[model samples]
Target: MTGRTADPGLIGLLGFVIATLTAQLEHLGVQNESPVFWIGAVFGGVVQVTAGMLAYFQGDDFHFLVYNAFGWYWICMPGFLLGGELGFFEVAGPARGVFSLMFAILALGFAFPASMHNSVLPVTLLCVSGGLGLQAAGAFTGVELLGTVGAVLLLAASALAAYLLAEKFVWRTMRRRVVPLGRPWIAGDPDRES
Candidate 1:
């Protein structure tokens, strides 16, 4: 497999940060859900999924899996909400819990493995998984606070992702790491930055 290309990781991180932050802001009542719908469909869906494909072409299987999974998540989840709002379909009550539970499971599965790479990946995954888990709890119990905490966790994840993207940009221009990505949970090669 080819391992040559402009970094798709940057694209994936950028999309992840934008979409997650926007969605979290909306979840916290700071932004309108309508604009978030577009952000999710385009930046979250198209850009991240395309980045996943690029990672696949680069022989980076882990990124291919992560970015694509979350890309589809952004697309499907937002579309489902938008569709419900438009009266196309209504998934309310316990059914919503079921749907959230499924995604929460997936996100949790990704979280631990992400620790092998860097603090960033694991932190992002754990935050997202925690957010989804809380969302599921919110749906099941009718507690808005659960969802609110979930939104805060998601915002934290987005902030971490944005830091990663900034780190890349600084490295590109300075030929040095100006913004550091913290150590991986599992130690890696001493020579490698991440």
Candidate 2:
């Protein structure tokens, strides 16, 4: 017990922001090809998983679950893509829709609890959930418009997550609440002392 607090949320959020933004760019056709595999594997998968483990050791259950879940999502996404590319299996459009839907549901499920934490958290989760839902719908219907919407939403979510990361890690570390995260939605929250 070093009595030291580990700020794994920062790293995890950073990983999420980068990977998500990269993917969104590809979806928007701003990038011709996705280099998401390596980025997701390293930053999203490895870094986030490490953050999850550290969060667990630090006794932050919320962060532990969030980080780990997203970490696995990042890790497995590449595997699925690679498998399809390698002809090991086919990744049909409907299958991709199902995959996106699953994560969208997961994000929504997590958003409720996150709402109790802080204003920024729930907002970020909601944006991400909405984006994922749009992506699922697009894949299912083979609609380009829905995918475009999803890409925009993902970009918004990434921006919000980046703000949260800066607030939590940078400003807080400097003992300056430079960015206001707003009040927690849950009234009379014990975690926050006003």
What shift in Å separates residue 178 of candidate 1 from its native position after superposition? 1.8
TM-score, predicted candidate 2 vs. hidden true structure: 0.92
User: Mind giving the per-residue lDDT tens digits that candidate 2 earns over 18-55?
Assistant: 98888788889887334777787878789889999998
Candidate 2 residue-wise lDDT at 159: 96
Clashing residue pairs in all predictions, respectively, total 0, 0
Give the alpha carbon lDDT tens digit for every residue of 9-43 in model 1.
88898999999988889989997888788999889
Q: Find the number of clashing residue pairs for candidate 1.
A: 0
Best by TM-score: 2
Each candidate structure's TM-score, on Cα atoms with residue i matched to residue i, is 0.89, 0.92
